[model samples]
Target: MTKVSTVTIGALALTASALAQTSIAQAQSTEHNTAEKDYRVFEKTFGATKGKRRNHTKGFCFVGEFAPVDNAILAYSNSPIFSSTSEVNGRVSHKGGKNLSPDDKFGDRGLAFEITTPDGDYHIINVNTEDFFPASKPADFIDLVRALGEGGEAVKALAAGRPELQAYLAHHKKNRDTTLRPYEGTQFNSVNAFYLVNESGDRTAIRWSMVPSGSQGIVVETNSDFLMDNMNANLTNGTVSWDMVVTIANDNDDPNNAAIRWEGEHTRITATRLTVTSTSTEADGECDAVNFDPTVLSDGFVVTDDPILEARSQIYAHGIGVRLSEKE
Candidate 1:
């Protein structure tokens, strides 16, 4: 029960009194109809790809959020392959072995999000990785929520000079049954919770997110061999964690897409008020992918493989945003 109720947002609430107070059998576990029509359109259709054995080895994941927003901003769909129309069974990078086509390979990393106080700096809207990543992993998730909004102590010194986030939290804390499986036909990786008011404004913080659930996101499988022969099955009980409503503009000069028109109208980001968990420790299967140790993200940011080929030649393809802390 983590704060979801834009009147329950269901039936993909494009609106109908919010689809009559939402509830098409829990509307894909609600969160403003699964965080904008199924979590960021299903991880911009599978984080643009780089799985299933790509010798570059590792690095490819992202998720973002920050609350109490005013110049609120959030925009995803960086376009690496949203439509040439099909094939994304592992997100991308066949390399020279040839045979790529999640719309002809993808992963050229380029991520941007901004919000610097002092009365200026407001440009937080990115997602364009239709495909590109000759070699990737330069600290994703929008560089860890702008490094916790640049606070003091800087996220425990970026968890002590990253070694790929300390070897991905010590290889998922003693092998979490080998994590990694939220990027294959998405479903239930929706959590973008952040609330900050630090800088000595009398304390208040929060951050957490999940967007590594690819393939146009929200896939949830369980045809049920009786729920996988009862292998401790819970399959997201009473799920729903959405509410990504942002609005904060200073005009990036809208020539129809550079977009910036806050004050209301055409502003959208809603998984419809949410916060629900029935005990699940973030991780899916066959783990490892959080990479951020270029000496703790080399001050102000530095992740290359050429932004994964510039996040697949930019425009916003591998669209992911998440800033978790909420409580330093």
Candidate 2:
């Protein structure tokens, strides 16, 4: 009797283990399928631009006429992407011995988008260089607007439109500001920013500002620990957010010109809570310390104090070699 009981118990345990393994496998398969779908969707929507620069991640923006409703913009993105400008003031401003015509030169720094629905009017402002607000060509803009109006089928169809999305999904690269060097506004307001600096030491700046959906601009704080804690939570919890970007055209007014176009925004994080980290290795141990600006080491073992460099070092040293455990 005792022998029979032991055999039966072992059989049950084995069955349970098999079932658990199957469940895990099924879950992984489901995730893979979902990722594939997202990939295909992304590629179809963004299209193929030969020289298109990647947006924050890999999205583009456009101009379109949309109506306000409880489900307008959200509904629009579900459908398609298709897609600016401004005013002047009285202060006499002059630069380079040129009398500045404020009306023609200075307009509202951002574009205002209005969508009216039964609930009320929804207004969204897009800062030119903001990652969240990507712009698209004129014709694409109209298609996106039409898709939103059509709804349901239009949205789903748009989602399934791309082939390159698979490549994006395969890489699974997280989009972070990877601008080289420190400029006026690299870190600011709990968000990341960047600007393109030419050999002449002049830069075209762009800032990435993130705030809750219903909230105004990013709440600049003076504490790093507090801000980091909140940011992680906000992102994990899916708190609605938007990015503010500013683009600058240096010595040029025409939008079609690429050489003059650059990202420009000032002040990344307020000075109070800013901290920069870099890696250095001595014969004895590895050290990570705060830095004022970027620094690089080609010999012995030291790393540039820039965030991009830090990320790369961590990846190469810890991730590739399995030298350290992953940390949040």
Query: Can you write out model 1's per-residue Cα lDDT over 1-328, one digit (the tens) per residue?
Result: 2222211111122343322233343335433243334323323333323222111222222222222222222122211111111111011111111223221123222222221212221212222222111112423433432344455356446646654444444543563332222222112210111122222332111111223221222234433111111111222332222233422122332211111112234433331222222221113311122211111111112222223323222212111111111101
User: Scored by Cα lDDT, where does model 1 land?
Assistant: 0.24
TM-score of each: 0.21, 0.20
The lDDT values for all models are 0.24, 0.25
Cα RMSD to native, each candidate? 20.5, 25.0
Q: At residue 147, give the lDDT of candidate 2.
A: 55
User: Model 2, 209: alpha-carbon shift in Å?
Assistant: 1.0
Q: Which stretches of candidate 2 lie over 4 Å from their true place?
A: 1-136, 163-201, 210-268, 271-328
Error of 1 at 179 (Å): 9.1
